[model samples]
Each structure stands twice: as structure tokens, then as C-alpha cells.
Target: PKSTPAPDRHRPSSAPPAAPAAARVLWKRGDTGRDVRELQARLRQVEWLVDGPTGTYDDLTERAVSGFQGKRGLPRTGRTDTVTWQRLLGMSHEPGKWDLYLMGGQPAAAPDLRCTSGRVLCVSKSSRTLRWMIDGRTVSTMSVRFGSQYTPTREGVFQVYWKSRHHVSTLYDSAMPYAMFFSGGQAVHYSYDFAARGYAGASHGCVNVRDEAAIADLYAQVKTGD
Candidate 1:
């Protein structure tokens, strides 16, 4: 007896759809961007990198990232991947401009005619650096901070009128160690605030040096009226 066979129903496929893949981040050496700068900055905070948050994934940055990965039990690939970045983000604080360039990496301007002549504590506002020049030769340099717009740092050559190794600002009541008085209360001195805050803060119309040891040495070398 031939009953019309019912058409076979099509079965639904049993295989499930593939899951969406996670995003990936991979920055190897030779990469250049703000992201690399951030990577370097974080590494600097952890003391894994030095020299720069120069915004380039240089060899140092590669080494630093690799070292950090190894320290955290990750593979030492020397390439900054998403996992490495995530771990670093967890470990480090976001960096400020000064944190990225703690030493004020601005290039030094050409020496002033005065600076090239003889011994001079040549200060450059544009570069934010102070160079101790001897007979036109730069012996040492350090990062410096100046007064703000309200109390602008004076421009023009000045001589060290007085030298006080342990001077305190009588007006402000702050310690002004290695204070080399030049004009009024505007002196080149070691500023704890400058050391800690970098260019974030300003002096009360004084030139502030961050490195205490360098200032001390400069204090010894500099004399009155010179």
C-alpha cells in the first residue's frame, strides 16, 4: 500500500557559532606614538626603564617591557602586548608631562654671547636648563624652574651678589638652600618643591634648581659679583 511519504524535514545544524575574538594590542620596538610614551612612563615609575618617555618604542623600552613581563611571570617576549599593557596599567600610575620628562628634556638653546666668554651660570628659559660654563665649555647642566606669569623670572645677565649655603627665604619663610642671590629676592637656589613637583609649580620670582647636589657644587664654585 503506497502512502505518500512525508517529505523529510531538514535538521538544524548542531555546531554552535564561533565566539567573538578579544581585541589585541601589540607594540614592538620601532613603534612611535603617545601610547609608547605612556608605556615608558609607567615603566619609569616602576624603575624598569630610564632615560625617556620619549614616545618611541626603542630598544630600552623593549628591554624594559620584557623585563617587566618576566618579573610578572609572563613570557619574556620583549614586545608589549595587550596582556603586558594591562598588567602595567594595573601596576603604574598615569604619568604627567613632567613625570615623562622629569629632567626637562627641552634642547638647550645656543649659548648666549656672555655664556661663551667665561665662567658663567648660563640659564636658558626656553630650554629650562642651567649650564655651568667655563671658558665657553659646558661643564654641567641641570633642570630648572622659573617664576610664573604673575611673578615673572627676570631676564638679563645677573651676578651672584651673595651666597648663602643654608639661607631661608625671609619673605616666604621657606628654606632656600644654596641661595645665590642675584637680583632682589630672585636667586638661583635649590627648591624642594621644584625637585618634587618639577615645572608644576613656580617660585616667587626666583630661579629654582632641582638637584641639590649640583646646586651645592655650583654654590661652592660661584662667588660674589660673578
Candidate 2:
């Protein structure tokens, strides 16, 4: 009786436990929060996903996340866990290669432009080039793609009529309209895919450039007739 089974030596202790586990990131599928928003942004940056203004997890985002995960040899859970988030943000062991901001880096400004009021708007649809005149001298000349015969870019004097940080086009949304739309509905816009000079040419009826800021700077240097 005094031994009393040694006070149950094999009994387990319950001392209020250890720290709680971290929360898992839920991507576009039953998730609606800031983390999902970040995931969408990162995915879009890498061209793995399309435009979505909402953070609620949807089927499109789920598919994109799965595709991205498969491409990276991840688990393909379609959920943005810590590992997925890290990979998406370029912080994982195998980071995403594409840099979205690289679109802002243009090769160079047009070198030869004629100085004149309307010369800045001279974009040749046939040659796929643009020419600008300043002070009666050619100041800028560069390769460009004008609209096709079906939707030709209007040939005339256009100004920096409208600037939009998030302009939506008929085919796509979230366009950056740099120089104005002098033609019917066409405008000089920033095209991320235009980084490769003359390699590709596709536009409804507008001029597409690499860097928006560069075009903006060029536009700023000009006047109505300077």
C-alpha cells in the first residue's frame, strides 16, 4: 500500500502546451485577405496570373497558382503557403526569374527628331517607326508599331492629352496611357512585352512603347510649337 504503484510514473504532463502553429496562406479559393492579395499581385507580376482587383479566392487564381506551382515543381496545392509565397516573391530557394519592373527599362530614346509642332505625332504605319521634330530639327527617331490596315493609327498631331495610371482597353485592363489619344480611340501606351525591339507588333490602333516614364519625359520636353 505504501508503494501505491509509484504514483503512476508513466503519466503524461499537460503544462499548457507550446507555441501555436503559424497560419497557412490561403490563395484564390476560399481565401479573402491581404495575403491572398499579395499572392495575386506576385503571380500577376510573373505573368502567371491575370488581372483581378479582388482578393477573394476564385477559380481563376486557383488555376494560376496550381500552374505556377507545377512549373516550379512545387506541391501544386494551389494554395499560397509560406513556401509558395516565398517562391512567388523571389525569396525562396528557386525564385521566380521574371522581373516585372524590368518592363520599365527601355533600350533608348529616339535619337533623331525634327523640331516642329506636329512632328512628334508622326508615326509611320508602314515602316513601323516613329519620328519627332523639335525646334525645326529631327530629335527623336525609333522603331515602333502602328495599327494595322484594319485599325490604322490615325496620322495627325496628337498631344499628351490624357494620362492614366490605370487605363482599360477593349482587350485588356490596367493600361498606362502615356501620350494622349489623338486618333479615334488609340493612344501611346506602355507595353511590357515591347521590351524586345521589333520582335513583336500587335495593337488595335495605338502606339506601344516599353517605358511609360521615358515617353512621358519626351512628351514633357515638347510644347504646342516649341
Candidate 3:
């Protein structure tokens, strides 16, 4: 007996079964959990998910995510994938309950100290707010927009050198109501586009006020010098 054909080296042995691969959970509409809640909270900080952190991904969240993805040149999948989550995380701050729910009133931001003297149209880029101040006292506040990266609004001290109640831009051929000229072509003016689109649009090197009534009142109060 050929000694027991040398123990077969190629024969398969019965081994314990391998574990199945874990399934990945892609956060999408209708998915509910802490992850979805966190996604909503982050979206809100960037002004995308205006109504939630509802803890469940819904139609509104999908639309908001799609819009955000479109703006950032990402594929408009509306679903939160790894790439989307990373992008959103990079752009937003850790969300607070107030931010997630938009509870309470608009949070107040400290006025820039440089704007604490005399009559000033104190615009803060960080806060995206305009504070109408007189002698260090804030008389009024309103939402405002600034130029895009290509035509950034000039910062630092500026003065109102001209005023035009119904000014139309000769360059861009756009109407700039209640225009108060400051740095070069930049002015504080009412932007109909801002009113309609909210923060979805940008101004052309100008401080754009969405509230027409507020800007009109401000235009009247502000003199050519201040």
C-alpha cells in the first residue's frame, strides 16, 4: 500500500464559517437616528437646513442638502455620504440646541469696536449684520450681504460720500435703491435679489440690505458724511 498516499496536501479542510460583511448605512430621507440629527444640526449652522435637526431626514432636509451640494459643486445626491458629511463638517461649527432649532430670537453679535464712534453704518462680515449706530449706541440692526469672492467688499474705515435714492448701476445695469456710496463703487443699498433669495446670492462689492423698508429709513437717517 503506497504507504497511505502521502497525506493529501491539496485537500480542503472544514473550517469555521467566515463572518458576513457589515452593511453600511447611508443617511438619506426617512432615515432616523442620532447621525441624522447631527447632520441636520450641521446643515442648520451653514443656513441650509433651516427647519431641522428634526432627528429624521425628511423632504425638506433632502432639498436643503441638494441645494448645499449644488452650491459646493458636489453631486446633488441629497443623501449624506462620507464625502458630503466631510464637506459639511469642514464648513460648519459644532451646533448648539439654539442653532439646531433656531429657538429664541436672532442671537446678538457684539458690534465691532471700530464702529463705536459717531454715526456709523457698522457692518460686520462675520455676523452678516448691519448695525446702525449713533455715538456708540445701536439704533437699529438688519441683515445684510456682501460681495462674492471675485468682488469682495472692502473692509476698514469708509465714509458715505454720495447718496442716491433710486440709483441704477451703470456697470452691472442693476437697480440699487437707497444707495449710499462709501468705498469706490461699493455702497449700502437695498437688494431685491437678497430679499427674494435670502443668503443664497451675493452682491457685487456692495453691502446689500434685504429689508427695503429698513434701508430706506437708514438712508434717510444717514447724511452724506456719516
lDDT of each: 0.85, 0.58, 0.82
**C-alpha displacement of 131 in model 3, angstroms?**
0.4
| Clashing residue pairs, backbone N/CA/C < 3 A, model 1 | none
Off by more than 4 A, model 2 = 1-119, 156-160, 196-199, 211-213, 222-226
Q: Is candidate 2 or candidate 3 better by lDDT?
A: 3
Between candidates 1 and 3, name the one with more favorable lDDT. Answer: 1
Query: Tens-digit lDDT track for model 1 on 149-201?
Result: 99999999888888888999888899999999999888999999977666768
Off by over 4 Å in 1: 1-35, 38-103
Taking all chains together, the TM-score of candidate 1 against the true structure is 0.64
TM-score of each prediction: 0.64, 0.40, 0.58
| True lDDT of residue 18, candidate 3 | 84
Looking at model 3, which ten-residue stretch has the lowest summed lDDT? 98-107
Q: After superposition, how far is residue 165 of candidate 2 from its true place, in Å?
A: 4.8
Residue lDDT tens for model 3, 1-226 = 4565677779776797889654333798889866777788788778886664557799999999889989989788888777778889999888764344322123458988988989999988777789999999999998787899999999999889999999999999999999999999999999988776656578999999888888889998999889
